[model samples]
Target: TAGDTAGDTAGDTPEDTPEDSPVEDDISSNKKGRFHSLGVGELLVVKQKLIAYEEGEIAHIENVMKGEKRSRNHRTLHRTEEFTSFELEKEEETKRDLETTTRFELQKEIDSEVQESTKKEAGLTVTGKYGPTVEFTANAGIATEKSSSKSKNLSTSYSKEVVDRSVHRIQEKIKEKRTLLTIDEVEVINEHSFGNLESVAEHTNGIYRWVNKKYEAQLFDYGTREIFEVVIPEPAAFLRYLATNHPKEGTSIPKPQKPGYMRLYPILGTNEFEEVFIPLSPGLLTKETYLKWVEKYNIQDVLPPPSSFIVTSIAFAIDPVDTGVEDEGDGSLTPNWRTVNMKNTELVVPPGYVAKIGTLSLAIFPLHRFILRGLFGEIAIGTNKHAFHQGGGIGGSETFVLSNETGLVPVAFSLTTKQFFSGTLEVQCRRTEEHMEAWQISTFNAIMNRYEVLKEEYEESISGEELFGSVDIQGKNPLENKSIILNELKRQVITQMTRQTFDEFDAMREGVLPEGFPQQDVDEAWSEGQYVRFVEQAFEWENMQYLFYPYFWGKKKDWPVNSRLEDTDPLFKSFLQAGSCRINIPVRPGFEIPINIFLSTGEFPWDSGEGGIAVENEDGEEERDIFLSIAEELKAQQGAVYFKSDGTVFHANEDLESVLTGDLIEEVNDDGDVVLNDDGEPVLINGTNFLEDDINREINIGGKIYMIIAVNEEQQKITLDENISIQESVQYGIGAKAIGVPWVVTVPTSLVMLHDGNKLPEIPEAP
Candidate 1:
């Protein structure tokens, strides 16, 4: 009820909640802060455009052609070349999709079921005035209103109704339910009977698609050829989601369900974002569509009035104690809990995208619930191989930089879904790097080869095992499940691979090892018999290096390094081949592939504490200040422009919902104007709610030139008349072709034209 118009104070990070080690994070989400990440789809937009030097003046892609000569009767005719968009290989895309679906094989973590999920369960009361109710009836089919008189015959209650008295009681309770509840207040402590959530088709063949941006998602026909994968943000948000929205809840909270993208995206945020999207197919219920689907049959009444569904909140500080920047910890980074209010909840929408038939900005963006999904590791590719790394445990003894000859790292997705609310969690890591070897890339040629055959085979096997060659997801698929293909692929990759697996030395790569890993040799290599001797040697090197050049990571910038004594474990020496990770020849894109390696160790040695996770590189002061300022500016503009930036410059055009309320690229400036990205080169937008029109309405870009492009509306429709080969399509379909630059159509405010420049044709819009 109490919203800080100026926003609230930041909260402490979960890491700061301090206890023992970062192992398994014993901290509850309330204390833990959520982590944010930019998806590959988003990176695909500004990856190349990123400025090499943050402080250097850089040149932009020249827009104006050198001195034009347009005299007398000569007129320029700009050629309009068509892109000739083609359909991607559906079969291959399907396989990739299924593989991701099978990724969540792990079960639940702690056993805590949501006993009863009800907004009004606490029985809080507002005691407010009543609004007028309208007569309405429960229509059977498509919304073609029944006789007005017949509808009017219905009884009276809250907002609008034409139903029975029993319906009236339930409806009133629901209305009160919504008004009395806030997301934080409405807790689903346990799972309810999601009444037979599996598919009810004749053969039990079903698949599901969940689009989670907040705590809810819309279920869809997993059978759709064009749709498949889902994305999630980082760890903290996701963990919270799991703790709150898991199926453990009872009748109090109906299986947390929401509508389709169009109805939900605006509520999430204003951009296509990182989500813990599961390509799962929940089975069929009697309910047919998202808008009217009823999971709990006893419910009836006015639908809950619109409210913030998913909220995004960020808490941060400039300095951290871990950096030891200050002796008294004055510079320590901290989370400001005051910022943890409801108003801080963030929702987003994609850029250059809009509602299907409205002036609305991009819509149908994903919403995440309890859990936000994301990359726990980073992967890089080089010459014949690549390197991959996940955050390692805290400590110097087992610390390492494991290098692999073959870039094939096991790419597996595992989630421990608690089968029951209250019980001991028996997590038996089942999903292996089944398709670990298929991931390939060439930085030189800029080609990234991925082998999904293994993933595809596994899906096929899953489909067959589910009684009658199918399992029950939320709904039924028109075709058979592809789990069989996924299973078969796994069989081949696993039974055939020699080096693409956990190695004997894997436990010793560097950092903390799982409880039982070997540790004898490691102790000998870094034997610190006399702390005094080592300390003396360290001081000598630091003094010598300091005279020549500034120290880097303590040593001189170019100090010749010796292998860490800590790396005596042989795992660092072993190089595994990734050839079997795939079954096909490679296709490389631009840029030479850089080798990548992964050990059990984390990318960063530092682990999060009770306070929070380690503060990332960017403090985002310039970006943060500019963004806050823009939000203030938007109030004057009636929510026209929203901002998303990586503390760098260019911001992508995001949707209005996100624009209205999201982190600003620029915080409020002294004069209270939108901050410019240095007022120079083309701005690289991470995501935005601001448009070209907003430039004039908000701030001055100093008349900067930004290339505007139109979208290929027909891109979504791609079955063709031409003859095509499956292999060729598979190579390019789901891989790189889908990743690219925004369409260059019209400027943010510039208008397209009719021949006479008087009137233009009207077209239905979409997100």
Candidate 2:
């Protein structure tokens, strides 16, 4: 109704509002004298205008000061002109600052207006006969561009026929869900429920094979027949024989009468004088005095001497009747009655070992008896035949190295026996050697001997008949050869041995060595190449012991080491590169081993018979059906259009019904001139009216004919009513008559492949 008169403002002359005035002279002259010449009515009008402006209700402004009278003197006018000139300059600066401050405030009001207008809820009416007589209005929830003579409306309700058609379309879409070949081809059959389910063959057995390719590759790379071993002394040994005799030759020593003891001859070449004794007391002589004794007795002249001439024993008196014999009243005693009790006995020297008189203070059955107290204490020396190899190198495997025939000084001495079945044998014999060597020559000799054989073999292979053959090597000793090849071999051996030793020590320190190994021996022998190489080879073999010995019983077996006259490539070079010994074993190719053993005994591991547990269907047919149903529902939703509450007519992928009301679709700038793309095609703007290609055609709108104008594919907007004169241009919103194109929304099925009983399937051929 009010819109019928809205066009009048465009042509009507401006009129003065009450607010289009200035201030009164009395109030303005007090401070702001710029409005000092205002009348009473003008003052009220200015006050009202200022108040309305501040309240944000000011709608229109009229030419309030236009065609008004003015009066000013020449001096006041000159002063005003000067002040205006200065104020003009200052205003330029102030305008920049004011623009920044008011920009956000002005933008907020514009944004709110745009949002409110987009709702298109408010009604507009142009009550003038110059425009169209019929007033078409877009209902709500759909904003439209400003139009004078044309409008469009989307229907809020559909006819019963339209609803029935929509329902039929939805059902058809659901029926189309089963047409998908992917879903149709999927096996929906469940596993057999009652029969022998375990016997029902499976596609996959669920066994994961972890094939050790690295081990296989290293096992059969280089030399397949060569073997290497590092020689080391036995961990435990004893004096097998007393003289120049061998045990295997049938001259074996008689077994001891009692366990944990050994009897020795006190005199040389005399069996009757056999007794565990030494001539000198423990710690009786110092190094200087023992050397003097050596000069007096010529002890060093003999390779090994009898124990009685040098070592002294404690003479125990035995009664003549103690041997179960009557005294006969003759007062004579036989030697047989004084049998030497070697059990838990101690001597100044060890049997079968040469000693320089008092040089060594030995003990026997040291654990049970307190013999040679400090020298052979439980804490000092543990389970040993001699004190020489008691500590330091090779787990206390070091031998003795005594300079001259130095005697041992007695630091402490004791020998007292207890009654039968009363106490342990007590013999405290603490000897203080007046001498000790820095580096024993015997220890050096032992270490050198370890490499001597290897060195000789290496030299022979390099320069002997194996290599020289008919070539003249007569003038040169192969063992003494200093050829380049031998030197290189020596260098490589040294480098490899050093690296292997370092790795072993590191492993030992880090506790990465095999369980129960002695880290002490490894640490000590790490510097000696012979022992270091030995440990390295032993450790490497131990790691792959599973492959060598199928039924190993946790026993250390000697690796066969033979000197090779010819150079051969090792089968496994990778192990050698890793500073590990290559066992020179060849692996058979294409050997397939089962990942797991299935011990089938005509029975399932878990019972599935009738009195036992019931087995459900293994295949997941129900889950597949559920997923297919979900896909059908989502497909049905594709046809359901959502009318936006924000009044946005054009939505992405949305089909709209509208009538054409414009000439043709074309891109237009702010001046409304047709724009063109680079291809010379008319660019179509969105949310604008457009007509079909045939502009002369008339389109039916609500059974009324409207001239078709243009068609806009980009905006999907159709223009109509080209003949009808519109006072302004506006967008024809949703509901215009247009062709509806069918669309379907499909999604990928969220189906997962499962094993029997809906279990997560195990991956095969892992690692």
In candidate 2, stretches whose alpha carbon ends up further than 4 angstroms from where it belongs are 1-313, 318-426, 430-440, 465-594, 597-767
List candidate 1 segments past 4 Å from native.
1-475, 478-608, 615-767
* lDDT digits (tens) for residues 1-767 of candidate 2: 10011111012212222324431111000110000101111000000001111111122221213233234332211111111111111111111111111112111111122222233555555444546565544432455553223334443432211100000011111111112121111112223222223444343322122111111011111111112212112111111121112222122322211111234544657544443524332243433333433443233332211223233333222222222333546864322222122222223332223343222233222222222111111211112232231221111112333222212211122222211111121122222222122122222233333333334334334333333344332222322332322232333332332222122223233343687554543322322333332222222121111111111121122122111111111211111112222121111111101000001111111221111212233573322111113343343223211111111222222232233223334567899888889998788644333334434333333334443455565544445544333333332322122222213322111122222332333445868
lDDT of 1 by residue, 356-459 (tens): 11110101111122211111222111111222222221101112122221211112111121110111111111111222111110110111001122222333
TM-score of each: 0.14, 0.13
* Alpha-carbon shift of residue 410 in model 2 (angstroms): 11
Looking at candidate 1, the ten consecutive residues that score lowest on lDDT are 590-599
lDDT value for model 2: 0.25
lDDT of 1 at 96: 13
How high a TM-score does candidate 2 get?
0.13
